[model samples]
Every structure is written in structure tokens, then in C-alpha cells.
Target: MDPLYDRLARELRECIVTGVYGAGERLPGVRTLSRTRGVSVATVLAAYRRLEDDVLIEARPRSGYYVRNRPTKAIPAPARSAPAAQPSPVTGQELVLSLVKASNDPAVVQFGAAVPDPSFLPVRTVERALARAARQHRNRAAAYAFPPGLPELRRQIARRMSAYGCATGADDVVITNGCQEALVLALRAVTRPGDVVAIESPTFYGLLQALDSLQLEALEIPTDPVDGLSLEALQLALERWPVRACIATPNFSNPLGYCMSESRKRRLLTLLGARGVPLIEDDIYGDLGFGPRRPPPCLALSEGTGAEVLYCASFSKTLSPGLRVGWLVPGHHQARVEYLKYVLNMASPTVPQLALADVLHSGGYERHLRTVRSDYARAVGRMIEAVTRHFPAGTRITQPAGGFVVWVELAPQVDSLRLAQLARAEGVSIAPGPIFSATQKYRNFMRLSCACPWHSDVETALARLGTLTANLSIG
Candidate 1:
């Protein structure tokens, strides 16, 4: 109905499949085709059109179209049976831990490690507060804080969280050394080793490290580049596996920088809640969003009777990673999680806890976060601009709403591991894609850290990487 080429293309497509021309055979000349088929030369052209459209044949200049060796569609018989897929028995912990240790080497620019530049942290503000708090409560510093965290600090957290619509109280908070310990304690309280847990396909490596240490099994769900894990795939996993809990990052996720949509968030929570599955949410980067305010936490979404979400976060990403001050809002699992925290670490260090409390209560911490957020936004933008100028064609970079990590997909020819080694040899370290994936699927992907100031040298390094990729092309 549209044109002769369209109809001819369809006819040629079927003719190719029906074996009018055998494999490795050249098709008849266009004029001969017109005479044999008794159709216009245009109709013959249209038939060959369909063949090329379906990739069944190729045309050569100075030569006619030739039949390709591609196999035609055939019925696929069912297999007799296949073994069920279980988690891989091998442990990736040592490999990852070694990489983590090596990434911090001074010779490396340390893009692999996600820590912010030390120069950017609010050291002076923290020090002043520590001095004032130490003099005021020197005796209390020696005494142990309560197991549920210091009341004043908890109140500050609750007030801040309440601004985002999360209804929490100091009575429901459990403080731990860092988000790592909080996550581990929550996992310990809710699940045991060998318990199946749903995780995003390319999730935070630290969480993988945690699951390895705890001996939990992971079922990776396919996730989007901008949003998080697919709800349909997750529902399928829930129907298939006995998933005890789910671990996700609804805010700017590490390595991916995806923010799950509010609609998807509600659907995810309700779907998982219905299955009686608990959610272990990591919100460490929530406060670092490039926008005015971070998205709401899953703990805030909890309602009466089915509060299965366990929210965990730390000030490390914002104020200081060394402080190691983090908390858990364990909806419905508060008491059990607190007991686990006590048995695990006794309590977080008293000096840092009170110092954090003093700084937060006095209103210096939020100001520091605002400053850091502004700096980080610039850093992320500069990195993205550098990537667009330097990366290969067909390359797409993640434009995170917040956080300083950018995920890059290189052309398939460039192996990230190889690129990583090359970058390392050149005095820069990068996070390879395999570590983020349980199946190591993203062989050509890499992550760059934008926490450092964007310097000419960094841009030059990216250009060098692009050159390296282009040189390695087989073409």
C-alpha cells in the first residue's frame, strides 16, 4: 500500500526464507528478475528490498545481491531437563577486598574508592564542636551512650527526617559505627546465611561484600539506567524464590546513580510487603543530591501494621567518612536490630557520637552539607562535560541528579579490566564493571569518581583514554 519497494521487500524476504535461492548463491540480475517474475523492475527491486531489510542477504557494488549463510527459523525442541541455577559457590570477597586495598595506594589517583576529597570535609566546624562538647561533658564521654543511640542525636535525625515526611522518633533509632555496621546488624536481625535476597543487577559492591560475609545468597534483578530495578522482574523473582529480604538504594544509587520513581517506589514497597519480605534500604547518598532536597526515604513510606522497611544511612558521605556515625530506623524491627547492634559493636565510639550530636544540634552540620552539595554538583557537571568531549562515539554517560559517581558505557571493543589496568599504569585507578555485577556482564563499562576537583590533568587523562580506545579498535 505504501510503495513498490515495501511490497517487493516483503516478497523477497519470504523468498529468501522459502529457499528460492540456495545459501551462497547470488540472486538473478535485476533485469532477469523483472523478465522471469513478469513484474516491473521496480517490483523485483522491492522483493530484494525485503531480503536486505531482514538481513537475509547483502548487496555488493558492481555485483548483484547474494544470499547469506544465515540459518532460517526452525522449531526449537524442548530440552529433556536442566539443572536449576543456584548461587555460585565461589566467594568474590577476597578478589574485591584486594582491589579495595590496592585502590587506596598513594600511587593511584584512587577513582576506584568512593570517598570524597578529604580537603572538602568540614574539619574546622567539627573540631570546634568537639572542643566545646568535650569540655561540657568530659565525664559523659567516659560513660557509655544508650543502645538506641544518644537521645539528642536521634531527635535531630528524627526532626530532619520528618521534614521529608518520614515519621520517626529517637525511641525508634539505632545507631551504629557506620552504615556498614548498621546494614550488617539489620541483616543479622532479619535474615540468616543462605537466605535468598533480591539485589539490583549492578548494585553497590560494599553490599555484595556484606552478603558474602553474612553468607547470604543474592538474586539479581534487571535494573534501568536512570530508575532502579524492574518491578516486573522483581515480582517474578518473588514468585519464584523464597526471598527473605531485599536490599536496594532508592535514592542516587552508587555505581548507577539511578533514582527509583515515586510510583515504582510505592509499587515496590507494596509488592514486597505483600510477600512478607523486608526491605534493607541504603540511603547514605540521599543527602548528597544535587537538588534542593533529597528524595523521601523508604522508612517514611511505611504505614500501620506492615512496616517491613529497614532504613540505614550515615553522615560519612556528607560530613566525614572517618567519623563513622550512622543510624538505622528499623520499622517494626527496632528492638531486635538494637539487640544485634549491642552484641556486634557494644556501641559506637562515644566521643564521635557526642561530637556529632553537638555539631548537628547546633545547626553547623546542615550548613556544611549545603556547601559540600554545591561543590559536588560542580564536580559532577565538569566530569560529564569532560566525558562527552573525550569518550568514543555511541558512548553514553549517566547524568546523576546527585552524588559524584558517573557510570560510563564504552564501545564493546574496550574491555574495562584492560582499561582499568592501563589507567592504573598511568597513575589513575578506576572501578571496573564486573565488580558491580554478580554475573560480570558489563565487560566494557567503567565508573569514574568526580569527588575531586576537575583539573586539566583529569581532562587530559580522559582524552588519553579515548585515544587508547580508538587505537585498540580492530577497524
Candidate 2:
């Protein structure tokens, strides 16, 4: 269905939920709604059909659609994190190792991977773009493309970055394999072995892995479920320890999805600048925001502040992840990052760059973003609703403003690793909380990915997880 119809469906869903149209009330006729909303009759019908699929409304044989009589449950977000202020080396790796293995298993209902399904991607468009790019650039398709990547792709990226308040040209953007490689390059540019880097308590495991690979110590900072990394904790940590750098995901961080306010972003920049510690920002989830406008990356606010923030992002989330395309905007470390890029893999693939540039230049990616973002919002809502209904009371889940992943904090009596083991026995997979912490904190928490296409099996998997959690709590 067109994104236009999805927007219409979302608006109607809100109206019904907010009691603008009471339960069992008949909705306007498709033709009438189409006329009123300035959309085609087909669009309105599609919208209604979608709502019916979601069981939000029902279609009568001789009557128009009516709202379903399902009661809404209020689920609360998790409390703020208060991890130990001291920096610690990543200790155990068993939980992440198990999650990594589960993520690739075909039989397990996949919630372990923090990635959207193929249904969320623009498969045909991307294929067409790739084919066209290879045909058009037949001469350069096989070449290395070298450091800083293809100029045209960088140019298109630079253009998109302008909307989010980042001021940069093609010269500043260095393409990498994905956001992971971008992050590795950023960490390398700023910190050395044994350097203490501050991070969110329940952070992305990938970041922890990178820090471990570089032999960097991680100072897990206190993070709010609503706000992002705590500046006060970071300030105190800076004062207490010899912190070398800070890494964060201010916009829709993994596991715990929360976008830092603009004021906080500026304050964070100033705070880091004062301490002479650079910030390696993971903006991978920046484009997936369920808002009117994309939140500005800290790099956007760092333009004139002289605060060095290594901005990293990728098309993996918004576009095709298989392409392995990502870029970085290293403020002062551009030269070193590009050199590291040269040393690591020589350069990113040439064809994907050309293809992405083609897709961006065509201007269809934004439309694609609208569809995926709405689909994720809908999917996340359903997943949260299922958790509330199936899981025990006192369960606190993160209410993400963007991104498909959410953090669930279960009762202290429940151990996420044990829950994960039990859920896997039932052919379900999840990222247990212990994997997200350097000091093995959040043992009772787990992060779930709502990127899968909703279906009965997926619903069953969540139910099984809830059952396992209940069993674990009892044990």
C-alpha cells in the first residue's frame, strides 16, 4: 500500500484510540472519507482494510467499518540507569556469543538481530538502481574507488546531511563498509589502547566489542529511558577518572531508544570540549525517527563550537543493509580516519556507492523512509502491546521515539540469560541484557527488535518469551 494510505490509517487509529470515535461506532463510508481527506476512494479502502487486519476495526456485511472493542493497556517505560561510575574492561562474552549464534539460526523466530526485515526494504528499487549504476559506470564499477569513496555518492550524502543541520561537503565524508566500520574508524581516530571511553550502560553490544577489540576500557554512564546519556554523570566521571573519549548514540540509541534533546546535545558538546575528550556518535538510527523532522546529530551542533565529534551513519537501517554502505563526518580527524579506512579494507565497494548515489539522487529514498518508519512504529506498538498483555506486571519497556528495537526491564528475580536459554528451547531468540553491559549489568533486562513483519508466529514467539520470563521469575 502507498504511504499516503498508511498515514490516513494512522490518523484514524489515533482518533479511535483517543475516543474521538467510540468503540463500536461506525466510521465514515470509504467514499465519504476519501472526499473529506482529499484522497482516492481506493486509498481510504486500503487504509480501512489495514486497520481491519490489525483488528482495530471490523467490516460489517451491509454496514461501514466500526471500531473494535479492545481495551488499551498502559505500559510504562523503564527507569533510568545508574551503572557504576568507574570504567571497566568488558568481562564476559557468553551472552553476546549466544545472541550472535541465535541471530543467524533459520529456525529460531528472529528477535535477536536489531535489523528490519526484507519487507521493510526497497528491494526492487535498490536492484534497479544497482543495475543502472553498474551499467552506467561500467568503467569504474570494478575499480577500488579508493579512500573517501566515489565523489558523487559523497555529494548526495552531503546534500542529505544539510537537512539535519550538518554543514559538510563531499570532501569531508569517508565511506565505510557499514556503521560498524565507521565506528571502528572513529574510535581509532580518537582513542588508543587502555584509554577509558564513556558509554551508555545498556549500550549496543557492537560498541562494546569494538572497545574490547581496541583494548579500551568502558565507563558505563547513567542513562535515562526518556533522555539519553547523563551529562552530570559524564562530567563527574571526567573529573574523577582519566577518561580519554566518549561514545554515544544520542538519537534513538540501541536497546534503549531515546533521542537527546537539542539543549542536551549542545551541553554535551561543551562538556566534552571542556574536558578535551572527543565524542564518537553513532547516528545509525537517526533517520528512523518517528517525528516530523530528523533530530540533528551532535556534529550539526559542533560546527562552530570547536568540539570534535566523529559522526557515523549508514544506509543499512534506512536502505539496504546488504550493500554494506556507510559514511563518517570526522570534524578534525578526517585525515586520520581516511588513512585508517585506506589501511583497513583499502576502500568500500564501488558498485554499492554508485547505486546508493543513484537512489539518493533520484529522491525516492525519503518516500521509502516514510513507509518503513510508519511500518516500524506500527510494529513496535503491536509488539509492546503484546508484551504488556502476555508478560507479568512490573515489566518496564522503553518507549522508543524512533528505531525498531526496545529495552525491556523485567523483575529482579528474572535472569535474562536463563530466559533467553528457555526461549531458545521454544524456538524463539532474544538479546539477553547481560550482553549489553560491560560490567554485566541489566541481568534482568533484555532488548527486543520489532523489525520483523508481524505475524502469528512472531506473536507466538513473544508469548513464549513472556512465559519463559514468568517461569524464570518463579525459579
The total of clashing pairs for model 2 equals: 0
Top-lDDT candidate index: 2
The TM-scores of all predictions, comma-separated, are 0.78, 0.93
lDDT for 345 in candidate 1 is 67
Candidate 2 residue-wise lDDT, 291-350, digit = tens: 878899998998556578888999998898889999998877889998999999899999
lDDT digits (tens) for residues 38-68 of candidate 1 = 7798888777765653346778899998987
Q: How many residue pairs clash in each candidate?
A: 4, 0
In model 2, which range of ten residues has the least summed lDDT?
92-101
Residue 13 in model 1: lDDT: 50
